[model samples]
Target: MAIGITAVAVPLANADVTTKANPEGIDVSSYQGSINWSSVKSAGISFAWIKATEGTTYHDSRFNANYTNAYNAGVIRGAYHFARPGNSSGSAQATYFASHGGGWSKDGKTLPGAVDLEAGCAGLSQSSMRNWILAFYNTYKSKTGRDVVIYTTRSWWSSCTGGWTGMGAKSPMWVAHWGVSSPSIPAGFPTWTAWQFSSTGRVSGISGNVDRDHFNGSAARLLALANNT
Candidate 1:
């Protein structure tokens, strides 16, 4: 139902996205330990995607604290996962997000939510792997009534998610591809909603490098992801 094209400035790239400009967000991982919340607040980071869980049993010690800090500072916030360990573990991680970050306002909008799946954790058959990923996706959908964006590499996007739209056709996508000025998204894939183009980004609060994200829609669309709208 949402449509348009915008070139989000990512320290790189101009892909085919629907909306005004690419929205800017950050994916914070353990790399951002001992953060200076004040510096992050001052850096004008419009949004943050924090690591919530790793496997079925491992959770980020900093997720709750980071979420609270971002919320307090009025930075739009969301959560993501390190997926692809296996299907069973994928389902477990999804459940983790549902219990922790899936709730929405009375109006039923949520902060943006995502699942970061890649090859190489414990590589299983593709079908089995997708089934496991779907288990989590289905749960998140049931809880939020909104699609959780899927983040994966260009290669994976081409081969993995090409045939699946089990979540919904209108759900947004977040693509991860490093290097080059910009990379075109694979054909058959819906337009991108977020582009994670760098793992070497330097932000004020972080000591080491951080992954930088760009939104493909307007400020309003991001608010929708945040469920603020």
Candidate 2:
């Protein structure tokens, strides 16, 4: 049986308590102003994970347009993927990301670019899929020289990522395991820098809804993440 939760869109009165550990966030498709960004800013929302590129043929239409709004509101923002499945080895998807990632610059603040791998795609071998991911990462890095972050569940990390110990330095991790507390991150997988804990979260200042995220360290640490990378 599935558990039920009665959720309301609460303002960040106790944001310090709420945005703790792997804090609250919403994974959004569009903005409608349903969430209160002022309250979110006042409430201390740590970060936002926005949808950027998807398949080679499709990208998030609203990402670049909306990211600036979030940034101006003092929200640290990141981007995610929807995985092209069989086409993971294609360069088009990478190019799409490279073109539409708002052009990250030196000393210009931008969240790490991330690849969201899931079971949405079919008919691709593990090697083929990994090749697709590498293609995107390699090509994008060649243009930007920035490392790419990987967003996956624990199971995907184990089966698809091979052993985390062997991952290249260009890869960081964003593990999704929504629950009350942060879950056990895999050892060979790598150190997860962010955790998605609750999808049921509601923050002020966003329209319709948004995904709330927490940097896996103190606010000081988060500053380091933003300034360094």
Candidate 3:
């Protein structure tokens, strides 16, 4: 979800300490290549969001290995889909994502799937974009019986969706804002469920830069989310 955009960092004096208290996580894709899941778990990473499918045709080549290995290493993980609204209908993309690695189970280690919505509005109007996203969320929920997590930046959400607040109650927000003490919340969401605070974070298992995240709760709360309790 780190597309390399710079934003003004929020001036929170205790942001670093406050963020560190929450559960730590990361999001990875084929760009990270092979990873040592054991080392990653040992590094105190509680969860991960692995890229799964993009649009209706492209699937992340490393999704299977990362998905299986991360689970085996005892890291709670979920899959994510990159939105390509210009290429296909949201329903089709959601179906593709679910059919691929985005399916969820009741097992304690699998988190619900997430949809990345950072693309440039896909040439659609605000209303149309909102509908596309709703179609995706509805289809994904029907397929997995879980509300899909929505990932986007505050700027993109405001510009593209006209800061629509409808999804705040339905889906959890995973806001991405790099180099910030605190992430900027989008219009509808009262607070962020997950925050991708840095795109250039390094982990022992990852080769280069990986996206660093924090679940906005404790370990038990994260498990509750995974188990849907």
TM values, all candidates: 0.79, 0.76, 0.91
Task: Note the residue pairs that clash in candidate 3.
Answer: none
* C-alpha-based local distance difference test score of model 3: 0.87
Whose TM-score is higher: candidate 1's or candidate 3's?
A: 3
Q: Give Cα distance to truth, residue 102, candidate 2, Å.
A: 5.4
lDDT tens digits by residue: candidate 2, 39-124: 66676775666777777666676776657666666666666666775754546666777677624553223566677776643666
Best by TM-score: 3
Instruction: Note the Cα lDDT for every prediction shown.
Output: 0.64, 0.58, 0.87
lDDT-better candidate, 1 vs 3: 3
**Candidate order by decreasing lDDT:** 3, 1, 2
Model 1, position 221, has a per-residue lDDT of: 64
- TM-score, predicted candidate 3 vs. hidden true structure: 0.91
Ranking of candidates on TM-score, top first = 3, 1, 2
- Report how far off residue 164 is in candidate 1 (Å): 4.5
